[model samples]
Target: MKKLLSFCLGILFTSTLVAGEVGSDCTFKGKKLSGKVQFVTSFPDFKVQIVDSFPDLKVQKVNSFPSDCGKWQEVTSFPDFKVQIVTSFPDIKVKYVDSFPGVP
Candidate 1:
């Protein structure tokens, strides 16, 4: 009985750890992180921080065709998502790259 209880506890802990991993599917909290993006100062859909390394997602700024994961097109109007740049307490951390933009 003790062995079975221990096994169940182990499985529960492992599942919780996996559930906390973010941006694996280019989405965070059910919101897609790709497509046309807008930078805002207030009331953003997501708060982001730019980091040099160990990013949750590697982003590539594109002029057009921001279709894939981590590809973002900057736009002023009708944005698919809005992000606020924050130095601290960000929802996600990202790094800008020229190539290979996706979950790291």
Candidate 2:
């Protein structure tokens, strides 16, 4: 009985550890600039998608190491539509979001 209990506990602990590991890809979906640009467990801090409108610039989240998210011009004006950068993820393609507005 003790062995079975210990095995169950070990499995539970292992699953919890894996669940705590941060993911490498995901996007945000909601109004831009409405909430803090913070990391959520389900979403990758390194990538996000603004649903209501496009942010003028996109930034990537780095995990304690230097990252090359690239230089993005700060978004001073918010658009009125949702946007997703289909060509890239986890890295900031500076001009990618800008192309969203011109999509025909």
Candidate 3:
């Protein structure tokens, strides 16, 4: 019984370490989106916002990982579009992606 308990605790600890975490990973309001969209940025894990105005925004995560990652860029076509990720207190960066369709 002692051996069983020890093994269970060991596994729990291992899983916790292996699981990658997101610090403030959730986007503006905890939503994901798809659209006639393409990519201007990429990350292994990210939170995406779709529109300029708040309230009806969306978030997106990636599956095209381990192949082509570590790329982030600006929204070329939608030059007026904007996105912000929390940096420090009262600070954020606006990085938007030009999403057209099936590219991201």
Reference-based TM-score of each model: 0.78, 0.24, 0.26
Per-residue C-alpha lDDT of model 2 across residues 1-104, encoded as one tens digit per residue: 99999999999876643312112321223323221233333433334333333333334322232122221223324422222333334322222333222111
The residue-by-residue lDDT of candidate 1 on 1-104, one tens digit each, is: 99999999999876644323455677997878789999999999888889898888889999999999999999999999999998877878889999999988
Clash count, one per candidate? 0, 1, 8
Question: In terms of TM-score, which candidate is stronger, 1 or 3?
Answer: 1
Ranking by lDDT: 1, 2, 3
Better of 1 and 3 by lDDT: 1
Q: Poorest 10 consecutive residues of model 1 by lDDT?
A: 15-24
Task: Estimate the overall C-alpha local distance difference test score of candidate 3.
Answer: 0.32
In TM-score terms, candidate 3 sits at 0.26
Best by TM-score: 1
- Give candidate 2's total backbone clashes: 1
> Distance from true position, residue 101, model 3, in Å?
23
Cα lDDT for residue 10, candidate 1: 100
Error of 2 at 94 (Å): 20
